[model samples]
Target: MMWPLSICVLSFTFLMILALSLVSMGFYFVMNDLVYFIEWEVLSLNSGNIVMTFLFDWMSLIFMGFVLFISSLVIFYSDEYMAGDLNINRFIILVLMFVLSMMFLIISPNLISILLGWDGLGLVSYLLVIYYQNVKSFNAGMLTALSNRIGDVALLMAIAWMLNFGSWNYIFYLDCASHSFEMTMIGALVVLAAMTKSAQIPFSSWLPAAMAAPTPVSALVHSSTLVTAGVYLLIRFNALLVGSYHGSILLLFAGLTMFMAGLGANFEFDLKKIIALSTLSQLGLMMSILAMGFPKLAFFHLLTHALFKALLFMCAGAIIHNMKDSQDIRFMGGLVKHMPLTSLCFNLSNLALCGAPFLAGFYSKDLILEIVSLSYMNYFSFMLYFVSTGLTVCYSLRLVYYAMSGEFNTFSLHPLNDEGWIMLRGMLPLAFMAVMGGCMLSWVLFPTPDMICLPLYLKTLALSVSILGGWLGYELSQGRLSFNLWVLRNQFLTSFFGSMWFLPFLSTYGVSFGPLNLGGSVMKSFDHGWSELVGAQGLYNFFMLNSKITQSWQNSELKTYLISFILWIIIIMCLVVF
Candidate 1:
C-alpha cells in the first residue's frame, strides 16, 4: 500500500535528484557562459509563429533548481506537519503542480508562454490558499486570485501589444527596441503586473491574508514560488525599464512597501503574518535594488532570502503545531527552555533576517545598503532605505523577545520538545544554507568583487541602525519603553500603523463596498421592485385581471343577454324603415 507519507518521500527524493542535476547544469552554464534556446512551433498564424520557447541560462536553471530544492524540502516537511490529514496526497499534488507552474514561468522568454505559467501560478495558488475549506481561506483565496488577475490581464495586454513588434518573444526586442514607445507601454504594463504579483503598496494586503493556508504552503510561497514570480519576471525584463521613469516609480513603491511591512511586523502578533510581512519587506528590498538598476544584487538577495525565510516558516510551523494550533506570540514564552533545537534554528533565521554579521542575509543586505548610499539618490529615498532596515531588526528582536524570553505563558504540561525529527530534518538543511548560502552566492554571482568605496560614517550607519533597532525592539516588546506607552495612548495612530495603514480594509472593503452597495440597490429596485412590477409577473397579473372580467361578462345572468338581443333588433328595424 502506498501511503501518503511514502508518496511524499518518493517525491522528495526525485525532486532532490533533479535539483542537484539542474544546479550543476546551471553552474556549468555560468562557467562556460552558455545559453540554450529550445523552441517548438505549436501553431502558425498570419504573420506570426505561435512558438513555445524555453530559455535555459544560468539564471533560469539556477532559479529552477533552488525552487525545486526548497519545494522538495517543504513537501518532506509536510509529511510530518500534515501527517493526520486525510487529503495529504491531494496537498502533495497541488504543491507539485505549483512547482511545475514556476518552472514554466522561469524558462519562458515568450510572452504567450509566460502567461501560461503566470496564470498557472495564480490558479494553483488560489487552490492552495483555499485548501483549508473555510470562509477565511476562501476569502483570502479570492483576494489572492483577483489580485493576481490584474497582473494576468496586464500580461495579456503586453502580449497583445507585442504584436505590434511582430514577435511575441520579448527577449528579441528587449535589447534592440528598448527605448521605443511600444517598449515603454510594455514596460509600464509589465511593472504593473510585477507590482501586483509581488504585493507592492496597495496590493500587499493579500500576502498576509494568504496565511489562511496551511503552514507548509506558507513556507513554499514565501520562500520561492508565488511571491518571487514577480521579482523574477522583473529581473528578466529589466532591460525594458532601464533609463525609464517606470523604474523610478517602482523604486518609490517598493521602498514604501518595505517600510510598511517592517513597521507592521512589529505590531503583528500572529506568527505567520509577521513572517509574511518579512517576506514582503525582503521583496521590497529586491524590487528597490532592481529599480536602482542592480538586478544582479536583487537576484542575489532573492536567492539568499529564500533560504532563511523557508526555514523561518518551518520553525513557526513546528512551534504552532506543538502549541496545539496556537500562533499568537503572546501565548508563547520561554519556549527556548522547552524546544531548544527549534529555538536555536528560529533565532538563527531571525538574526539572518536582521542581516546580522556574516550570516546569509548579511552579504546581500549589506551590499545593497552600501550601494544605495553610494548611488546618486535624494535624502528621502535614503532615509526610507535605512529606516526600513532598522524596522526589520526592530520587529525581529521584538518577536524574539515575546516568543522566547519571558516565563511560560501557556499550559504547564504541554509537550513542546523538538521530537519531530522529520520536521527538524527539513529545517536543518535550510539552516545550513541560511548560514552559508549568501557567501557562496556572492562568490558565484559576482566573480569580480564590486569596488564599493564609502566614508567611514556611511559604512557604520547600517550597523548603528541595526543595533538601535534591536535595542528598541527588545525594549518595546517588554512594554517598558516610553514609546510603547505613547503608542498605547494613541489608539488611532496605533491602529493605523498596525493595519498596514488599513490597506486590507481598503483592498477588501473599500474596493468592494461601493460595488456591493450598488448591487444590493439594483437587486432591491429592479429584481424585487420595479422589475417585478413591470416584467413577467406584472404582465401575468394584468392578463389575469382582464381574464377574470371577461369571464364575469361571459357568465352574466339571462336578463343581460335578453337586453342585448332587444337593442340589436331595434337598431336593425329602424335602419330598414329609413
Candidate 2:
C-alpha cells in the first residue's frame, strides 16, 4: 500500500522538477535571443519600454529551491500524518494546487502574471484552511480570505498606478522614484498589503485565528509559504525600496509588530498559538532587516526561520496528536521521559529560536541584530530590537519549560511514546537541518565584507543578554519573581498587551476625530442629511409606497397591449421616415 503511494508522490515530484527545468531553459533561450525578441514586439502607446528582461535570476532560484524543498517535506510529512483520513485525496489535490500556484508566483514575468498567480495562491489557501469544514475552520478561512483580499486590492491599485504612469514593466517601475508622490503612495499600499499578508503588527489577529486548521497546514502556511509571501514581495521590489521614506515606515511598523507580538506570546497559553506568535515576531524581524536595505539578511533569516519553526510546529503537532487534541501547555509537562527523541528535537529547535550560538537561528538572527545596531542607531529601532530580542528569548524558553521541563501534573492515560516511524522520519531531517544549516553560510546571500565580524565585547554582550532573558523567562513562568518592579506585568498592562487588534482600529479611525464616531455623531449627521432627501426609511421604501398608487391607475392587460401597439407604430413611422 505504501509503495503505491510513494510511487505516485515521486512521479508527481519528478514532473514538477521537469517543468521547472524547462522553464529555466526557456528563460535562457529568451535571454540569448534578446535582440530579436525586442525587435519582434508590438509597441503600445500606453506601455513603458521594457528596460530589463525577465529571467531566472540568482535570487529567484534560491527562493524557488526553498519553496520546492519545504513543500516536498510538507507533502512527505502529510502522507504519514494524514493517512487513513477520508479526505486525503482532496488534501493531495489542494497541496498540488498550492505548490503549482507558488511556482507560478515565483516565475511570474510581469505584473499581470504575478497578480494571476497571487489570486490563485490566495484561493488555494482559502480552500486548505477550510478543509476541515467546521465552524472554527470556516471562520479562519474567511479571515484569511478577507485579509488576503485587502492586500490583493492594494497590489491591484499599485499596478493601476504604474500603468497610468507608464511604468508597468518591473524594471520601469523600479526607476519610478522620480515621481515621488506616485511612488510613495504605491509603496505605502504595498507595505500595507505585505503587513496584512505576513501577519505583521496590527494586521496579526487573523494568523492566530488560523490555528483552527490542521497542524500540518499551520506548519506549512506559517513556516514556509503564506506568511513569507510578504517578504518575497518586498524582495521583488527591493529596487523601489532603496532611498524611499517608506523604508523607514517599514522599520517602524516591523519593530512595533515584533515587540507587540513578543509580548502577546509571553501571555499566550496555547502551544500552537505561541508558535504562531513566534512566527509573527520572526517576520517582523525580517521586515525590519529589509527596511534597513539588507535584503540578504532578511532572506537568510527567512531560511533559518523556516527550518526551525517548521520543526517546532511539527513537534508540537506530534505532542498534540499523542495527547488527543489537547493544545494547552498548562496541561502538558514532563513527557521528555517517555518521548525522549521528540523532546530532544523540540528542545533543539527552541534553542535555535532563542538564538543559541552556532544554531541556524543564532547566525541569521545575530546578523540581523548586527545590521540594525550598526546602521540604525536611532532610539526607536534600537529599543524595539532590544525589547523584541529579550521577549523572543522569553517565549522560546517558555515553550521549552512548559512542554518539556515542568512537573508532570497529568498522568499518561495512554502510553506516552514517540509517534510512528514515518512521522519521525519526516521530522528528523528538519531537526538535522536546524542544527547544521548555519554551516552553509557561504551559500546564503549577504552583504560584501562577506563575513560579518562582531567585536568580542558585542558577542559576549549578546550572549549574556540571551542567557539573562532565558533565566528571566523561566523565573517568570514559575511565578518565582516578584511583580512589584515590573510595570508591564500589571493587570491593565497585560490586558492592553493582549488586545493588539485595537491598534489597527486606532490607526484607522482614532486620528480622524469626529469621523471615528461610528454610531454617535457621524450616524446622527448621516441620518439628518439623508432623511431630508427620501425620508428615514430611504429611497427603496419611498418607491414601494408610491408604487401602490401608480399601479392602481394601470389597466394591466390593456396597458400592456396599448404599449406594444404604440411601440410598433413608432418603429414603423421611423422606418418610413428614413
Candidate 3:
C-alpha cells in the first residue's frame, strides 16, 4: 500500500524539485505567451498542419502545478480510502494515467494532440467510475462516458474545422477568429465542447452521477482536472469567444448552471452529492465570470476553488469512510467528537468554500463577485451570480450543522479514530493550501482587477446573501423551522431539486431513449423481419428450390437412359444432315 502511494509521492517530489525552474519560465513567459512547436507532425493535411506544440505561460504553469498538487493529494488519500481493496494497484495506475492525460491537455496548443488528452480523460474516467463493479457504478459510468462523448465529438469537429485555418494550432488564430464566421463556428463548437466538459446546464447531470467513482477520483475529476478542463479550454480560447454571440450564449448557460446547482445543493441530502452539486455551481461561476470578459479572474477563482474543493472532498471522503460508507448527512451527526481533526478540516474547507474572509476562496470568490458587480450586465445575470454565491453558503452551513454539530447518530461506537490518520495526512498539504492558496496565488496572478465603482448596497450584495444563506441554513439544520422552499419539506421543490430540475432526465433518456428504441425497432422490423424475409431467407429458399429441381431431373432407370441416348443420337444425325 505504501509502495503504491510512493508513485504519486515521487511524481510530486520531482515536480516540486522542478517547480522553481518552471516558475521562472512562467514569469518570463508571462510577458510572452510562449508557444513551442516540435517538428514531429503526426499527420499531413493540406489545410491544417498537425504538429506537436506546447504553450507555456503563467496560466499553464500555475494550472498544471495546481493539478499535479491536487492529484498527489488525491492519490495519497486513496491509499487510505481504498485500503484492503484487491485492485489497489490498478486504482493507483488509473489515477496516474488520469494525471498524465491532464498534463497532456495542459501542454498542447494543437487541437489534434489535445484530442489525445481529451479522449483519454473520457475513457479512463469511465473505467474509474465503474471501479466498484456494481450496477450503480456501471450506470454512472455510462452517463459519464456518453455525456463526455459529446465534448469529445465536438473537439473532433473543431479539429476538422481548424483545417480551414491551415494550422491545427489554435493559439495563432485566436484574434483572427474573433471576426471571421468560419472561425466563429470553431468558437461555437468549442463552447459546446466546453459546456459538456464543464457540466453546464443541459450537460450537468453527469457530474453528480460521477460520484459513483471512488472519493479520491471525485476529488480529482470534479474539483480540478476533468470538469475544469472545459473552463481551461475556454480560457485558452476566451479572446476569440468574447464580445460575440457565442460568449453571450456561454454566459447564459453558465448563469443557469451556477444558479441551478446552487439551488440543487441546498436541497440535496447526500453528503457527496451536495459537494458534487457545489462543484457544478462553482464551475458555473467560473464560466460566467469568464464570459464577463475576465479570463484571468476566472482562472484565479478556478485555482483557488480547486485548492479548497479538493480538501473539501477529501474531508467528505474521510467522514464517509469512517462512518461505515454511509453518505447521508441526515444519518450523520456530531462527528467532531469522534474525529476532531477531520472535523476541523471539514469545517475550514467549508468556510473557505463559502468565501469566508481571508480564507483561500475569499480571495478569488470576492474578486469574481466584485468584477461581476461592476460589469454592465442584465439584472438576471447579476442576480444569478449573487444568488448562487449565497446558496453556496447555505449548503456549506447546512453541511456543518447536520454533519458536524449534532449528537452522534451511530448505533455502535466504532472508534473511527486514528485509522483516519492516514487520510488526514493526505489532507494536511491541501488544508494548508486551501487556507492560504488564494492569498498566495492572488499576489502571483494580480493584485486587483480594474472595475467601476458601485453603490454601497450593490457592493455588499454578496455578503448579504452569505449571511442570509447562513441564517436560513442554521434554522433548517437545527430543525427549528423548515426552509420548505428547497430542502426537506416541499414535495414539488424537493422533487425538482432531487431530479436536478429534470435536466438529468432530459439529457440521459431524452437524448438516448429515442435513438435506442428506434434501433430496437430496426432490429425487430428490418434486421430480424424484412431483411430475413427478402435477403437471407429468400436467397436460401431460391437456391434450395433450384437444387431440388436439378435433383428431380436426374433419372436412374436403364430404359430412361436408353431412350435419352437414342434421342441424343437422332438429334445429332438431324443436325449433321441439316
Candidate 4:
C-alpha cells in the first residue's frame, strides 16, 4: 500500500505538470492550428516516408489535456479504491499505459504512425480489461480484444488503400479526397473501425462485458479515452465525411446505438453496467450528432460526457468497494443514508447525464437536440433521437430509485460509513467540473451557434422528453413492476432489451462461425485432396505414362504399326464428327 500510494502521488504530480503544459498549448492552438513534422527518411524506397508528424490543433490539445487531467485524478482516486489489491502496481502501470496510448493516438497525423498508438491502445486495454484473472474477466477481455481487432484490421486495410495516394498523411488529403472513390472507401472503413472501438450498435457488446475489469480502468478507459477514439477520428476527418453516404449511414447506426443502450440501461440492474450503458448512450449521441454535421458539438459532448461519466463511475467504484463487492442495485437501497457524499456525487452525475439544465451534460446535449431539430432529417432519425433522449432520463431515474432513495436492502448489522476522505477528495474536483465544465467550455470551444429565430416548442422538446421520462420512471418502477401484465405478456421485448438486443452474440459467433466452417472445408478439399492429387506427382505421372505409350507405338513392329494406324484412324474420325 505504501509503495503503490507513493507511486500514485508521484504520477499525479507529473501528470498535473503535463496538463499545465497542454493548457498553454491549447490556448496557443486556438488562434491557429499547427502541424509539425520531424522528417528524415528512415528507408531508401521512394514511398517509405516514415516521418513522425503531429497535428496540434485545438482539438488534440484540448482532448489530450482533458485526458491527462482525468487520468491523474483517476490515479489519485485509485489510491484508495485499489489500495487493498496485491497487484496494485500492475494496475497503475496498465492505467498509465492506457493514457499514453490515448495520447499517442490523439497527436499522430499519419495513418501508419497512428497505428502505433491504435494498436498500443488495443493491447493495453486488453491487459487492463482482464486484470482480475477470473473466468468472466478472461472472457470479457477476449471479446474486447477481438472486437477491437476488427477495427485494427480495418485500419490496416485503409492504410494499404491509402498507400496508393503516395503518402499516409491523411490529414493533408481530407479536403482533396472529398469524393475520391478510394478515399470514400477509406472513409467507410474508418467509420467501421471507429464503431468497433467506440462500441456502436452491433459491436457494442464488449463494452458492458468489459466491466468485468476493475472499476478504475472502467472509469478511465470507457468514460474518457478509449471509447471516444472513434468520435475523435471522425472529428479529425470531418472534411471527408460531410455530405457522404457513409455519414448518413453513420447517423442511422449511431441513433440505434444510442436508443438501444438507453433501452438496455432501463432494464439493467448491475450498477457498473448501468453506468456502462449510459456511456454507450452518450457515445451514440455524439456519433449521431457528428453524422448530422456537427463534429464540434460531438467533440464538445465527448469531453463533457467524460467529466461526469468518470465521476459517475468513480462513485460506483467507491460504493461497490465499500459494499464488499456487491453491485446489484436491488440490494442497495437507502445508500444516501450511509454514504451521503458518494451518493451526492452519484446523483449529480446522474442528473447531468439526464441533461438537467446548466450541468456539463446539458450544454452539449441541449445543443445537439437543437441542431438536430434544425436539420432536415427523416422520421426515423427524429424518433430515434427524441425517444432515446427520454430513455436516458428514464433509466437514470430508475437507477436513482433502486440504488439511493428507499429502505436499506443490505444487512442491518453492516457498518455503512462513508469509506474515508481519500475517496471523497478525488471525487470533489470532478463533481465541480461535472457541474460547470459545460458552461465554461461552451464559451471557449465554440461560438454560441445562432438560434434566436427558433420556435419555443422546438427548443424545449428535449427537456419535455426528459421530464416525461422521469415521471414515467418514478411512477412505473415503484409499484407492481413484475406483476404488470403488459410487461409479463411482452416478455420477449423485455428480454430483448435486457440482453442488449443480443449484440454480443452477433458480434462474436454470428461473425465468426460461418467463416470458420468455410475455412475448414477449403483446407480439406484443397490442401489434402485436390491440390495433392493434381500437383507435382500427378502431372509427372501423366507425362511419363504418355511418353511410354508413344515409345511403344514407335517400336517398328507389325503389331505396333497396326495399333498406331487404328488409333490414328479413330482420332481422325472423332475430330471430323465433333
Candidate 5:
C-alpha cells in the first residue's frame, strides 16, 4: 500500500522538479541562442555512421518541460482515477514509460534515435490502450498499434534513405536537403510518417477508437504526448519540408482532416469519443498550420492546446468517475449544479478550445487563422479552414449543452459531485494554464509579435464564425434547428458525418477485408490442400507403402532363398554337361 502511494508521489515530485528546471534551462538557452549536441558513436559502416545523439535547444527543452509538467499532473490525477484497479502499479509504470519515451523523442534529432523513441512510443501505447483487458480495448489497441505501425515503417524507410547521406544525423543536412531530389524524397517519407502519427486524413480513425483506454491515459496521450509526436517531428523538419510540393500535399490532407474531425465531433454522442475527436481536430490544426510553413505558430498552438485539452479530459474523467462510469452525454445533464468546480473547468476548457478571447487557445489558434487568411491559398483550402473552425466551436458548445446544462438526466440516486480533491488538484493547474498559457507562450516563443495587415472583415471573420458556430451549436443541441429536419430525413448524411465518412470502417474492415480473405484462401489452397497432399502427407504415404512392400519381401525371404538355390544347382549341372 505504502509503495503504491509513494510511487505516485515520488513520480509527481520528481517530474515537477524536472519540469521547472527544464523550463528555466529552456529560457536560458533561448536568451543565449544556444544549442548543445551530445553524440556517442555506436557503429561505423562504409557510408553511414550509427550514433546516439541528444540535442538541447530552446524548442526541445521547452517542449520537454511542458510534457513533464502535464505528465506529473496526470500521474497525480491517476492516483485517484485508477485507485481501485488491481494493476495500479503497472498502469503508473506504463505512464512513466510513456513520458520517458516522449522525452527521448523530444531531444533526439537523429533518425536512428528518433526511431528508437518512435517504436518505444508505439509499443507502450498499444500496451496502455489494451490495459482494460476487454475485447473492445483489444480491438482499439490493435487499430491504434497497426495504424502507428504505418508510421513506424515510414520512419524505417526514412532511416534507410538517410543511409545514402552517410549519416542518420539529419540536422546537418536540412540546409542542403532542399537542393536534392533524394532528400526531398526523405522529406516526403517523413511527412507520411507524421501524417499517420498525428492521425491525419485516412489515418484519422484510430484516435477516436483509442478512447477505449482509461481517461487518464486519454488525457495524457491525447494532449501532450502520443498524438503530438508527429507534429513535433514536422516542426523539427519544417525547414526541409516547407516550400516543397510535399507541403502542398500535406496542406490538402491536413485540411480535410480538420474538416472531417470537426464535423464528426458534432455528431458524436459518446463523451470520450467527442473529446477524442476534438483532439483529432486540434491535431489537424497543428498539422495543417505546420504544412502551411508556420512551424512556430503550430508549435505555439500545440503547447496551448495541450494544456487545455488535458484539463478538459481530466474534468470529463471526474464527471465519468462520479457518474458510475457512464460516458454517454445524453445521460449527463445539470452536472454544473452538481460538480460546480468540474463544470467550471470543463466550460473554461471548452471556451479555450473555441478560441474565445484572451484564452490560451485564442492566442495561437486565432493567430493561425489570421495567418491563414493573409497567406495565399486555394479556395478549397480556405473554405476548409474557416468551416472547420466554425465546426470546432459548434461541437464544443454542443458538448457543453448536452453534458452540462438542462435537466439532470442521470439516475436519481447518483452521487455526482466534485469531491475528489486530488482530481481537482490535477485539473486546477491545467485550467489556469488553459486560461493564460497562450499569452505566456506567445511572449516566450516570439520576441517580436507577428504583424497582421488584414482588412477589418477578414480580421473579425474568426470571431464572427465562432459566435455563429456557438449559436448553431446551442440550437442544434436543443433540437430546434430546421436543419434537424434535413438531418432526420437524410439519415445517410447524418451517418456519413457521424461515422467520420466511414473512415473507421475503411481503416479497419475495408483495409483488412481483402487481405483476410486472401489469407483464408491461401491457407485452404496451400496448407490444407495441395501442400498437404504433395508435401508431408504424400511423402508419409509413399514411405509407408514402400516399407510394406519391403516387409513382405523380408517375410518371404526364406522361401525365396530355397527356390534360388535349386535353380542355381540345375543351371550349374546343365553348363557342365554342355
Candidate 6:
C-alpha cells in the first residue's frame, strides 16, 4: 500500500511539473499574450480593465521550478520514513495540500489570492508541525500558529489599505508607483509580515522550537515552504521595496539575522535545532542579498540552500532513525563507520553549506557577497559583508563538528546502518546536486561567462574559516584547550547588533543619570504623585475603586434600573423636542 501510494504521489508531482513547464514555455514564446494565461475578471467600474493578473515572468518560473523540485524530493523521501506509520495516508494528503498551496502562492494573481495561499500554507504547516500530537510539538505548533496569525493580520491590513486606494492589482499599483510614501508604508507593513513568516529577529525564536515536527516536515518548511515565503514575498514586491528606506531597513535586519542565527547555531547542542538556526541564517543572507537589488543572486541562493539543507536534514533524520530516534549529537559519533554513504552525503551537503569553492553554496553565497561588496562601494557595508561571511563559516563548521566528527561514544543501544534502499536512493540525488548544482547555474540562469567569475579571496577566506573552526571544534570536543568556553560565552557578541530589550524602554522614557539627575527627579515626582492619587498599587487600585463604585450602584438594582430607564426616556424625549 505504501509503495503504491508513493508511486502515485510522485506521478502526480511530475505531471504537475510538466504542465507548469509547458505553460511557462508557452508564456515565453507568446510573451505579448501572457495575460491570456491568467484568470482575469473584468472590474465593475471599468468594463475593459481586469482586477486580477498573474505574470509568468522569468522569476516566477524559476521559483516554481524550485517549489516543484523540492516538494518532489520531500515526498519521495517520506515514502520510507513513513512506511509503517498508520497515519501515512493523512501525511500524503497534507504533503499534497502543502505543495498545492505553495504553487498557488507563487503564481498568485493578486493580493487576495496570495493571501489565500499564504493562509493555506500556514494552516497545513501547523498541522504538519504537531503531527505527532506530543506536548512539545503541540507547544511549538501553537507558537508558530500564533506568530503566523500576526503576519496574516499585517498582510490583510496592507491589502485593505491598498484596496481603499482603489488599486488592488499589481499593474495598477506599479503604474501609480509615484506615491512612493504610501507604497513605502505598505512595503514596511509587508516586510513585517515577511519577517514573522521568515522567522527574522524577535520572531525568530519560533523556528528552532519548530524542530519538534517530523524531520521531513522540518526539511520542507525550512528549505522551500514557510521560511522562504518571506524572501519570495519581498522579491515579488521588489519594485516597490527596492530603492526605498524600507529596503535599507530590510537589508540591515537581514544582515543582523544572519549574524545572530549563525551565532545561535554555534551554541546549540541539538543537531536538528542547529540546522534550524542555520536555515534562519541562510534565509537572512538571501533576503539581504535581495535587498541589494540582485534578485537573481537571491533566487540562486534560495535554490542552493534548499538542495543542501534538505539533504542535510533528511540525513540527520536517517541518523536519528538508526539511533533509536536520539537527536543529541553527544550520543552520535563515528556512525560514519557504519553509515558511510549517509555520512558522505551529509559531509558533502555540509561542504556546500560552508560554501566551499565550486560547490552549490559557494557559487550562490559568494555571488551574494560579491554583489554586496561591489554595490555597497563603501567600507562599512564591505566590513559588514566580510564579518557575516566569517560567521557563516563558523556556524557551518559547528554543525559539522557536533554531528559527524566526535569520538564514537559507546552506548547500550547500538546505532544501525542506513534505513533501506528507498532512503538511500532519496538522498543520493540531493548529494549529487549539492556537489554539481553550481555548475548548472551558468547554463540555466546566467549564460554570460563574465558573470561566473569565482570570488577567489572570499572562497579562500571561507575555506580557512571552515578549517580553523572545525579544528578548534574538534580540539574543544577532545578538551585540547580550555579556550573554547570563552568563545562560547561570547556568543552574545555576535547577536548584540540586534538586542533591544533595554534600549526600547530607555528611549521611550528619558534615561536617568543619578539621584541628582533631572530626569530621575521628574520620574520620582511622577511616581509619587501617581502613588498618592491611586494608592500604592497604582492602576490596579484605581480599577478596583472604580469597580467598588459600580458594585455599590448595582447593589440597588431596582433603583438603578429605574434611573437608567428615566435617562433613556429623557434622551428620547429630548430628541423628539429637538
Please give the CA lDDT of all the candidate structures: 0.93, 0.75, 0.84, 0.87, 0.91, 0.74
TM-score of each: 0.91, 0.81, 0.91, 0.89, 0.93, 0.79
> What's the TM for model 5?
0.93
Considering TM-score, where higher is better, how would the candidates rank from best to worst? Answer: 5, 1, 3, 4, 2, 6
Task: Give the better candidate number (5 or 6) by lDDT.
Answer: 5
lDDT of 1: 0.93
Error of 1 at 476 (Å): 0.7
**Candidate 3 residue pairs in backbone clash:** none
lDDT of 4 by residue, 300-415 (tens): 89989999999999999888888889999999989999999999999999999999999999998988888888889999999999999999999999999998988889898876
Model 3 weakest 10-residue run by lDDT: 480-489
Which candidate leads in TM-score? 5
> Predictions ranked by lDDT, top down?
1, 5, 4, 3, 2, 6
**For candidate 2, lDDT tens digit of each residue in 276-375?**
9899889999998888787867877887888899888888888888787889998888979878898999999999998988998988887777766566
lDDT of 6: 0.74
Clashing pairs in 6: none
| TM-score head-to-head 2 vs 6, winner | 2
Clashes of each: 0, 0, 0, 0, 0, 0
Tens-digit lDDT track of model 6 for 328-372: 887777777778899999988887888788888988876776566
Error (Å) of candidate 3 at residue 131 is 0.9
Error of 5 at 215 (Å): 0.5
In model 5, what are the clashing residue pairs, if there are any?
none
Candidate 5 regions with alpha-carbon error over 4 angstroms: 2-5, 41-50, 481-483, 557-578
